[model samples]
Target: MDHLLPLSRVAKLVGTSRHALQEMIRSGTLDTFDGMVELNELLRAFPDTKWEDDAEFRRITEIKERAFGKRVFERALPDKEVLAARLFELGNEYAATKALLMHYSQVLSWLDEKIDEIEEDQNKETRHALHVLRAFIVRHLAEIPPDAAKVQALIAQERILKIMSAHVTIKPSGHEFIVESNDTLLEAALRAGVSLDYGCSNGNCGDCRARLISGEVRKVRAHDYVLSQAEKDSGVILLCSCAAVNDVVIEANVAGASDIHQQQLVVKVKAVEVFNPQVAALHLLAPRSQRLRYLAGQSVRLSAHGASGRYAIASCPCEERHIEIQVLRNADDAFSQLLFSGLNANENIELEGPYGEFVLEDASTRPIIFVAFGVGFAPVKSLIQHAMSLDLAESIDLHWLADEAGYYQNNLCRAWADALDNFTYITHASTTEVETTLANIVNDYPDLHRFDVYAAGTAAQLQLAKRVFLKHGLPAQQWRAGATDA
Candidate 1:
């Protein structure tokens, strides 16, 4: 080796300890292929000595725009005094412009509210814009101040209008149902009175995806961050995301959601103990005065100032008042940092919802097959716990899959593993044994059919499991898969 300094040397040069350097490498902040700093990336990550160990802090400030750039215009509607007369007298051009502006105003108001909740130093400027936008929305119509910055933006909007005004035809659904305003198809086909599927008005969960059979749409606010480019390209747009560019034809299958009450809860962390090196069991207790009830498989979004993330409730619905969530520490993940960096314990955090519709149906004893992968074991753990408590039929089978023995709390998982007589733990550790355990088990057991399967995990793992289940003659309709693109 010509001159390779050890990690210790680099740490000393950067005025930090060896342990900090190791943490950085483990979390990918400092890259080292063979004990040598990929000097360029390392320097870029820690441009100053102050950020040597505080890598996340530096990274967050440097990358705020990409993460929190989704701000909406919250300004009030335009003055009716000047434009109302002109707008009323106008034909197609007036109607289109007015509708577009109204959409912008609504989106901006919503965007500002969301931005207000985010606390980051780098987001101050964006937050300021949100404040201004909020004021405009409350006023209903305020002049967009003429500024050098808005000239180009206004030009772009005019171009968009030109593109959108192109004439197109909308195919009628030919039904009698309420036309959901958010659904561009149903909105366009209003004369036909066809319905659209919608669950929560919140776009955080995706349920309103539909095919744009033809024609185009100019989004109201680009609030459809839940959509992937692939989904967009495949003609799938959330009724929540589309505003008709031109009249368009669409296939409509609307699913109605039951009324759900939303609540704000304050949960105190009761325990944060390591289940395994990578997995942790977190117990949170709601305020004694607050009575919050959630279904077995629903998830809650947890928020601490400057941070927010969704975690599936891991405890049974019939369990004690306290809620339990299992968290896997991904060293590079921001939420994981809070968990491991002594920020998760004994802290009071805000929680929203008991969201998602993945719970088991009642009155019908549909055989359930639970397939959990990695940290996805959390929700299955809850559903199983609920089923056991309710004394539901032993007709349920849970298949818990992981890559290694030490991936999660073996003892906690084992506790459930041992107590539930109906449940079978399928431990797959490809890291150790040479055999293809997963494929082999499916191959050997031909009796896997006749049960409904619910699979949750990373997209690839879940997809693989689905393929395997289908290959073994499992009915596609009986299987439910949950995968988050994030």
Candidate 2:
């Protein structure tokens, strides 16, 4: 004869909420017998529920069959309510079973909202009692069956091994990468050539910072970077020090098209025009069949003979065959001297890359604020021209800071401001004036967080500007910075 249990008893037996079981009954998804549900019917309705000791139960039945009992234990499955009552009776002596009973009681109290109604002192007492009971159970369980416990522990270890070998999926791009148990997320990403932003992979810098969107990860090693309390609470982890404990999804600033594999080519210099005594614009032309593919605001390594330098591509990507770079001559630098004096038209130069992540984010529709210092304007010019070509509707404000001699292309910038309805230009000649200008800009647009800020300058200048912008309520995610090559 099948024994029937109440809905609440079924909920307790299955470790599910009573409300869920009630919904099944109300929706006609489950049939009740005399205000109760049969254990078989509940299992049929919730097929995914895990029943403890199922394998042991089957083994016991087989043993009985092999022993002179013809399927004696076949119909021995007890009613959930009766089983639960009998387990509580046994729990008075078995510490492990007692701990399970306490856990279920606390869960039921929480579900009934009774925990919230309890006094803080009573709650603390209950929690402390539960903790002590759990410890006692753990200590006692170790003495029950050493060999069986060892086998169960090995089974748990195998389950954990499977979880640790799971793959990680990067969001927005849906890129999948496997994470070894011993490897950090950044190490796995680098091995797979995933092109994530990173610097000083030892975690001294926060460049490899990413948010854990879903799943679990743990810090596998200590990190030098100091994260704020809010960052920790928000699930931000340094990829260089974090390893996935299970399949995980992370949100990070992934590399786009410009970050793909770089190509090496030898190109001919078409022209080298000296804008002033200190600055020159060098134009180069790649072979018609092998034009360079790159995004605006990316820099390339240019080498001729023994001199090599990293210079930003000042021209827009639309001019594929023609590459323009602005070089600031330095008295002590070999590459600068070579470009200023030793370079000539039609000279062969080796070009290596189109690197850097300073390009404009097309996904943003917010207004833009660009601040450039000295030769840092090179990439800014390329970005602005590209934005103009795209006919982006957002307003653009450009702040150029340099000595009088460095603003050789001031007229061109003014021309852009005059031609484009959405563009605005401002120039500052002194460091103090630049600081004042940036402060005034922030004051003028009290909501600085609504704009995307791009800054290019010396490392010191970029750092100072980032601090100021962040203080003025601009989010770190809304700002990009590029350090000018010395």
Candidate 3:
């Protein structure tokens, strides 16, 4: 079911060479060489095999056939060998993404089957432990380092598998094939000698959105985010939430246009001003000797003691001396409590950033609508300020929304409006004044078709707005979102 088993593994198990595995696929004996046996075929060939009634295996096989147009026979799962062969055969051939996802679902289902089998084994403690460890190792092979000595040590002490053979094939992209243990997709691309474009590794930043051109991946953690069902249907994936389930080929350019390097600055908290009862505005001064460079609307990572969190830089890129961030107390958040109450003004907080791709585009002559929810206003504030500083003559609508008006600071928008000539600020108190969604407001607008919208906030609100935009026939590329969890 899991498509990414090491080829070396299948080679050892079936006594077939990796080349022969590929040859098998080429010669039509196997659909893939990914170290998977067709479920039905395996059952028929070996009636005494243990997996005949395995639900996971059956589920995987069914899903694979239904989703990817691939027939699963004898064990019904293709390991890495089969996957690689298929990728090679389908090189750049267009296939339905939905079909591919179905295949992935099937693979995961099969893995679940294997896990169940191992868990059900009534064996010695050591054997059971080994089984569990092997399952983990097989499922997470991409995360293991290729070091021989370290792997040997793990095999000896942890009862891990000694080796899995894989054909180390690299495409003509001349992309360095770098594998990582516990590395972000962006980090892996970099190590693999690819210039993968990424805004933030934190899921909160949506800079690394792309499609999984091929292969399977596992979804893991995410920040509070939002995306349209249509986007998901279209194969758009967030690299932040994706981990390799197999050798994957994603439709993302490493050297994309958005790649940027910002100068790092270790700054000290010079002052903390409570902008409102709920929101605290933090100002940092470049440590007596260092300065950080970042564009407006970029974000940063902050660490206090040992815990760290991500926040958007509210200051303009030109401001080298002072950096500012507006944070609202999340009474439910441990990090927020520490920042607002426990941290001192002079305390040294670790900072890293000026990373984010939510900036205004160059050819964006269309009117702009900015929608912000809660503290999601941080990046929006920066973009607005930067637009004014650059003196870009553009018509922009700032639609700021919150559950309660009093909980939000109105002065920030008021100041920006007073300073700028073309900016229009509209506030919605979702609690009492306007409980309607932003998409409703966009729909009510006179010239919705003339504006390019950027939305950031709750997943529900963004989804509503996305549907409205798409319903009105806005181009998918024109409506950009910040981050999406769901």
Candidate 4:
């Protein structure tokens, strides 16, 4: 049997982003069968992949880690039970393959005997042809392929990965993620920036229940929401509690913005990070059970010390339990003033929303251009980090047009640009000629029609940027903008 791997696993094995592999597939440089690549195909595509261990693989992962400044799930051994189940599955595969090989060997032996009997009774020409065929088989079987060691090392690494992590595929929506170590399906999915539907993540609500289409899942966490015998018999499992033992396919809903209801929570301030005199970041941690469920590029209403303001979240949703909002120190805004001076760690703050539609088109694979004007960088930053987490774009270009603040998070942007070849950071010093800057920026994208532009600014600034982008080749509907202020 030809060993096959999914595109996601092939990406991990090759130390390339899924988007890069996708590009290869689209260009016909790599071929896949039913969304899977044969083992030979994978070997052919990545002939230089170092399969001994993770040191070389860590190169790509390290860059992604730097680009996304969040503590991703730990890559460790799986739970003993899940590990045992995976081993059992692998053992079964091994046994079946061995059995087939033995059967093939017996068939070859019988064929040899039959050929000998025929050769003994045949003419000289027929017997000579038979002898030549036998010699050909013996010669090829005796010689090992040149890359046999490489193939063995690669398979060994893949088996270890299989024993440690399991890949998951969500149907209908077609989102994919890996279930690493002890993570439940829902935990892994959320960590991967896949916003599936769920409420009360600890599982009192049945909102997270989905039908398991295939593979084995063990319940890791207890839940109050009990399924009926019928549902249980039909393979219904709580995504929040069940851990996949091996590769799996499931039917689940991928939630959209309107699909997600506004959430309310009282969170504790984690820290107040002031970046110069003009800006500070308010980092808040939600209650473990009631963590905020919001998409990137959306605004949340935050209140502390009798002052409240709506600010775009400056952090990715993948950064679990932690919510970050950048505040511009405005004399007129009490919340901004509090963030700049009064907010301390562990202070209680009210949070509500995730309001606005200025979100990344998660499904779009087009190269993306993000334009942030002044404090407008708040939402754009969130969108950028989220895009990084999801690997949603083929390439990303960030145009941060500074006002008086002047690219306060310049170092962070530089770090991302340095770590990712596909990411470009262009900082515009506080420019009086904003339109000229916008025009110059748009001029760089001669093929704007094939791209998606996400711009965040005040209403006037967004209008100006949108006009410039559309005046170039950008499609009108492809332009998404968020108004940051009056």
Candidate 5:
């Protein structure tokens, strides 16, 4: 029997990123069957992988844990009841395999006896051939394969992963992610940058209702929202209240830009991170009961102390209730002045209107080119991080044209390029010759039509960039622009 693993799981098993595996598949270096990798094929592809030593795998796990403000060995485990169910399922598989192996062993013994009887009735040459065949079978069966230890290690690691996490697939939309560390299906979806519809994440409202198309789920939390018997009979359950018992396929509605209704809430200021005299980032924390619902590259209106302004959100939605918006120092903007000089932590701020359609084309697997002019990097940063979480882009190249403030978060961008195999970072010095710079950028991509480009800047800058990119063979539809003042 051939054992197959999903691409995401295989990426974890081999201590590599999903983007790297996708690249290998596109280049014909690795083979996948129905979007999954066979066990033996995984061994063949990564010959140098030390299956017994998982230090690299452990290192990646540590990074992810830290990202969630947790430490190693402290990752949340599945609920006890869910754990028991998974263990029982594994035991069933082991028992079935053992029974099949015993049956095969009995068949081999019978064949050995039959061969001996045939040998006794045959002539000298035929008897010698039967004896050789029997000896060959015994020798091969007794000797262990060279990769037996590796295979054992691989299977052992995979079992632990399955127990600690469960894979989830969203039907119709085809979004896939792993439910890890005691997170509900809805929580996992949001963290993976899959925007499924929901209200009151603790499940008072039934907006997160989804149908289980396959596998099993266990309710881990109580919900005030009630489901009808008919809905229950059809496998409908609240995503916020349940956890996947094993791998599951769920049919849920994914909210698009227009699908997300405008939300207003009172949030508290977390911090003011001033990058320079001209720019700073405002970090806001929403209440546990009411988090703002917005996609990456969208803008929000913030008002505090009767001073208000609209700014592009600089944080990815995967960050949960934490919201980051970079503010540029401007004489005309009251919020910018307050943020730079007087915005205090724990101050109450009113947030409203996640307005803009400048989001990612998440379903597209095409290469992406992101262009940011000055503080327009806010939304671009959001889009890039969202893309990273989704792991759908074939490649991402970021071109940041600095203003007088310069690349304030230059190190952050470099860290992204360092961490991701499919990411590239390029910086252009501030210049008066805008058209020349735009022309040079376009000239670098001869196959521009094969790429999707997202640019954010002032209206004039966007228009100039768009005209130049379109002239260089970029499809008009492939270009997405966000209007930014700073």
Candidate 6:
């Protein structure tokens, strides 16, 4: 018998503990045969062990080395190469004859099985047998050099068909939409009602840029928009020009509320209340059949008698058929004067859109900070009401800033703070004090990294607040700003 000793015997012979020998095997430093250690592997693992000095161990090691080399050579050679070498060496013997007989026996056995199957099938047709025979001949014949290209072309066609039939999945949102082989991603998304932000159906703008999280997509048309090298390397694709080639997962900005088409409606003015001499609240009712479906914090364009202005919706989204807008009277502006003075109850006005992306992100569980300046509070009020309706558990802090004359909604703010346990309202009397207030707020929460900060104000105020918040550890993604239209 070959000297393949058990691990315990090997450990004893090598003057090492059984645990040490086992550790070597466990860590792959030593190899074993079955459950026993091979003599050559034991020697290789501990070349300087005292057992090597013994005469018996030296003889056993020499025998193991010779057998190991023989086994390696037998395994390294291919079967065909070994058989061919054996035939050349044993031509005078019956080795080649035996191999030829074995091949013929296998062929006969396969044919016999096929014949039995055919004979047993009572409903077998002659055409079926002919078809099988034709297929077998054609398959073998296609392997010939003259027909090989045609066979390969058929395989490539099948693979292409498979790739053209793949579906796409948008990640994080888990929206699955089908992209036909010839259609661009944007077309498919629009067709499936999966709204992705886009501008110009053509590829001139990069608004439809989305990251390819996994799988494959191919550009189906030319794009004029130049993407940065980093964007390209990060797997960003232009949705208007790319078609999915396989099961793909993409990261895209999909707004559910903005997915609906905008409508041009004639809404009736329900009522108008002058909250104060400088500020007024206007209520408009859309036609019941064409009620507006909009997100909170979105603005609408209202035109009355050729004078039009964009105003944020002050009412919560729960009031779908009716909307309330807060208007700050501009003494110099004729449009503001018409909205505040000329507009009357029961009068019809043109209302378009529910535009703007200032909606709340319900996915976030972080605390929220809302900064509203002057009539910017209109949208903030809507957002706060919507958040409250959703029963969101996050803490909400509202900082309302207005000039002394425009701060007419302090009572409303007070009512909200008193009603909601998680809500806090802080009013700043002057725009000049906004910077100091923001600075102090940031100082109080040194790590605003996890807070969703929203600022709605004049362009200058928003810009200043953006700089301060960004400098104070607010991530760009977590901070959103809506500039009140000039």
For each candidate in turn, give its C-alpha RMSD to the true structure in angstroms: 28.2, 24.1, 25.3, 1.8, 2.5, 27.2
| TM-score of every candidate relative to the true structure | 0.44, 0.47, 0.44, 0.95, 0.92, 0.48
Q: Is candidate 1 or candidate 6 better by TM-score?
A: 6
Total colliding residue pairs, candidate 3: 28
As for candidate 4, its clashing pairs are none
Q: For residues 271-386, what per-residue lDDT tens digits would candidate 2 score against the true structure? A: 99889998898989987545565677888999887988888888865453678998888876678899888578898999998788888775565789888888889899888765
RMSD of 4: 1.8
> For candidate 3, which ten residues in a row score worst on lDDT?
158-167
lDDT of each residue in 232-278, candidate 1, tens digit only: 78888776455554334566553311334566888898888777667
Q: Residue-wise lDDT of candidate 5 within 1-486, one digit each (tens)?
A: 889888878888898777789889999999999888999999999989998889978876665545433122334788788899999999999999999999999999899889978888799999888989988999999999999998999999889989988998899998889888778898889878899988778878898999999999999988999999999999999998999999999999999899999999999999999899988999899998887888999999999878999999999887778999998899899988888877788999999979999999988888999999999999999998888778878899999999977899897788677666678999999999988998989899999999999999899999999999999999999999999863
Local lDDT at 104 for model 6 = 76
Worst 10 residues of 5 by lDDT: 66-75
Q: How accurate is candidate 3 locally (lDDT)?
A: 0.55
In model 4, how large is the Cα lDDT of residue 224?
A: 87
- lDDT against the true structure, per candidate, is 0.55, 0.69, 0.55, 0.87, 0.89, 0.69
The runs of at least 3 residues in candidate 2 whose Cα sits more than 4 Å from the true structure, single-residue gaps closed, are 1-259, 432-434
Candidate rank order under TM-score: 4, 5, 6, 2, 3, 1
Best by TM-score: 4
Model 2 local distance difference test score? 0.69
**Residue pairs with backbone overlap in model 5:** none
- Least lDDT summed over 10 consecutive residues: which range in candidate 4? 66-75
Task: State the TM-score for model 4.
Answer: 0.95
The alpha-carbon lDDT assigned to residue 185 of candidate 2 equals 85
lDDT of 3 by residue, 1-486 (tens): 422334433333333334454455557655533444443332233334232233444454354334211111223233444345435544433255467878987887787677667667556885678677767856775465544443343223211121111122223332323222334454345322244455545565566677766665555455445666887788777765665544565677544225566555567888887766677778887763345545556677777777666777766543435778877677665556777785677778778865667666633446677877766687777666545432322567888777532436576577556544457888776653233555567666666666778777656767767887767767677786654211
Model 2 RMSD in Å is 24.1
Superposition error at 380 for model 4 (Å): 1.5
Q: Can you tell me which runs of candidate 4 are displaced by over 4 Å?
A: 52-54
